[model samples]
Target: MTPTIPGFDYQRVQVAEGIALTTAVGGSGSPIVLLHGFPQTHLMWRDVATDLAADHTVICPDLRGYGASDKPADPDGTAYAKRTMAADIVTLARALGHERFALAGHDRGALVAFRAGLDHPTSISHLACLDVLPTLDMWQVMRGTNAAVGFHLYLMAQPSGLPEQMIAAAPDAFFGHFLDIWTHDPDAIPADIRAAYLDACRHAVPSIVADYRASARIDVDHDQADKDADNQLDMPVTVLQQDWGAALGFDARALWSAWAPKLAHTTVTCGHFMAEEAPAQITAELRKLVDR
Candidate 1:
């Protein structure tokens, strides 16, 4: 059986024409949506969502191409772009009766949340992004030997057939590599949850690759257009990230500040999967962000 957040109710909510997201919702007061990262599902937000659900409505959803969500084919390449996925999120929240709410995301989800804040500024009251730079800054900073850390990004960024075939040939190994190396605490993922993640990725190789591919192309163009227009996030924002700057030789805070004027940047000591490895810390930071 698939594991789910203990008290959360799961449902299918149509966020766009012919696309409905598998969402898990709990609690009651203010609404906040949590988007999970790559190679994982809404399950990644289990602990944090449960805790936050105490006073706030916590909505966690499998992104369009991940977990149990609908994975529409990307015939035109725009289907999986962050701009498109971000719109899905905005619609999801409105369909649930929230015109504005706090938004937070990790990894790929962070990219979506970043775009949402830019494209739907009034709809996101507050924003928090975990462990990822904006798509444009991400490409700008990754260089030389340090760029090797993002090999999967380059591999998936390739045109259609090759990346999909390469990843589909060995889905578990391809998806499992990030889960294995990026976590500081093995117990955080456990065996069952890890198996579930692997199974999800094993079944969604093509759409997942399309998501990353969009990042390399159209997503970058959108971010660049926003940058050229001097458009920035108009809401208060909180960023939590591992110290990639010291390792990659770029100031992570500076990169983030260029887009988010009202920003609080923190260098986390936990691994990249900070939400799972350090739920208490992640919860506290998110609570503070929501209050801001």
Candidate 2:
């Protein structure tokens, strides 16, 4: 049976130039877009989106180069940069007649939400990020022995061709490894969903590798440039992350507060895949963020 998030309707919309996002729409009232992280899809929010759709209009999209979205060739890292990916969401939302809406993202999607809030300050009403820190802070603290926690970052940060080639050689195993390792609750994601994720990653290895490679270099530069310009997110911001940075000798909340003045930061006892592992808790947190 084709998996479906209850109360949600899925569709593919042409959101930008050569970019048509696979989006799931449901509910009524104010619109909210939920972006999923790496090695996952809109499927990550299967439970949470259905619940949110009971009240607000919940829109979940597989970000460009992931899932059912368009996978155009990016000549340089700029194309996969968070700023570019965020713009794609902005375009998609506006095209759907939502001039202003709350935005929430988990993992990689959260990075894009951060960029969207900064780049399009007037467009985003509320912003929520799950299980991530600002790109600049993340890079600054990842060094020496502490880097082992994120060894995949180093691998994905390499030349795009190599990681893409290597991952493609065993796409199912390569992507499935992260899926299995990142979640605190293994049963949260069903086998079919897991297979779907692996299929998507396998098919889009080049773009996926480019997305991470950009994060290592160009993405950091983009984050720093925003900081230097004092272009902070102007809306209410909520950041929910695992205390990995704190364990690694960095104050995660303190750093987040610096970038988002009207911010509520909390550390949750969950693995990197917070959405999948703790859907109810993540959903409750999101409601608070949206209600705030």
> Which candidate leads the pack in TM-score?
1
Q: Please, what is the TM-score per model?
A: 0.99, 0.96
In the range 58-121, model 1's lDDT, one tens digit per residue, is 9999999999999999999999999999999999999999999999999999999999999999
Candidate 2 per-residue lDDT, tens place, 1-292, comes to: 5466777788888977777998889999889999999888898898888888888999998999898899878786687899899999999899888999999998899999999999898889999998888889888888889889788788999975787778889988888888878778888888888888887888888888878888898889988898898878879998998878767898888888889999998778878888778878888988888888
Alpha-carbon error at 165 in model 1, in Å? 0.8
Q: Candidate 2: lDDT over CA atoms?
A: 0.87
Which whole-number lDDT from 0 to 100 does residue 264 have in model 2? 91
The lDDT for every candidate, in the order shown, is: 0.95, 0.87
Backbone clash pairs for candidate 1 read none
